[model samples]
Target: MTAPAEPPRFVVMGPSGAGKSVVGAALAERLAERFPGLRFVDADDLHPASNVEKMRAGIALDDHDRMPWLALVGGELAAGADGRVVACSALKRSYRDAIRAACPDAVFVELVVPAGELGDRVVRRPGHFMPASLVASQLGALEPLDGDERGIRIENTGPVDGVVTRVIAALDAGW
Candidate 1:
């Protein structure tokens, strides 16, 4: 019989409103049966209050504002190296590099959706500090997963369960 695949260290990454939280949660639930210690961390929880306030005020955060938050998220991922599913914006290549520095084997799952969809999703999301007005800025900062990156880009135009299934299949295939 084939050996079971190793539990994945997944970072559900994308610009705002790409369904990172929903998909990551679903992925974690699906993987929990096999990976007992798996946990999900919402990177937004690591953001400083000031950053949250800024975003709530419709101000886009700069790289400097994000470094500390990224470091914290990286630390969590590294600490949970055995099995973790984290939802994070991870917009810039440099930010992703920071995450990789902490957990070298991390597999990023980048969620891609059209701008209009992204905007609508962001606007409809309740209680999120990130305002729809900043969607463009987040998109502008986004750096797609590169050839050398250990990652996959999934279009999130459909149901959350469908996206989660694709992620699981990709992980099983060692993508």
Candidate 2:
């Protein structure tokens, strides 16, 4: 008899205001219907207190401050036996590399939003540690997925449901 297909591991990645959390959560919920035990993890919750404090204080994090946290996120993704979806501001190629180091099979879904709109969304968001001021820094640091990466990018305008539908389609297409 044939073995069942392995479950997918996904990182919903982008800059700070690119709707990673919302999109990742929704995607996990939808996928869980088909892949039982799939879990959604918001990488923001994985941040060390110092990192959170740095963001809360409007200070952009440097590589020294971020590497450990990225390692933790990677470990979490790698530890998922069934399937996992994580929302993370994996802005730099090096950061994504860090995650891939731990979970080489991980796929990515990057949500793209205009800089102006991203700024607006972050400013209006409440209680989030990352301030709107950091949006520019994130955009400046962002590296879109390389051609060889296993992933897809979708414009994240209009309703969220539409964006989710696009993600599902891309996954169906074997992205």
> Which has the greatest TM-score?
2
**Candidate 1 on 1-175: residue-level lDDT in tens?**
1124655678999999999999999888878877777899899999999999999999999988988888888888878535789999998899999988888778899999998899999989998889999999999899999989988998887888898888777766877
Clashes of each: 0, 0
TM-score of 1: 0.94
Candidate 2 — which pairs collide?
A: none
The Cα local distance difference test for each model comes to 0.87, 0.89
Predicted structure 1: clash tally: 0
Q: Which runs in model 1 stand beyond 4 Å of their true positions?
A: 1-7
By summed lDDT, the worst window of 10 consecutive residues in model 2 runs over 1-10
Q: What residue runs in model 2 are displaced by over 4 Å at the alpha carbon?
A: 1-4
> How far does residue 85 in candidate 2 sit from its true spot (Å)?
0.4
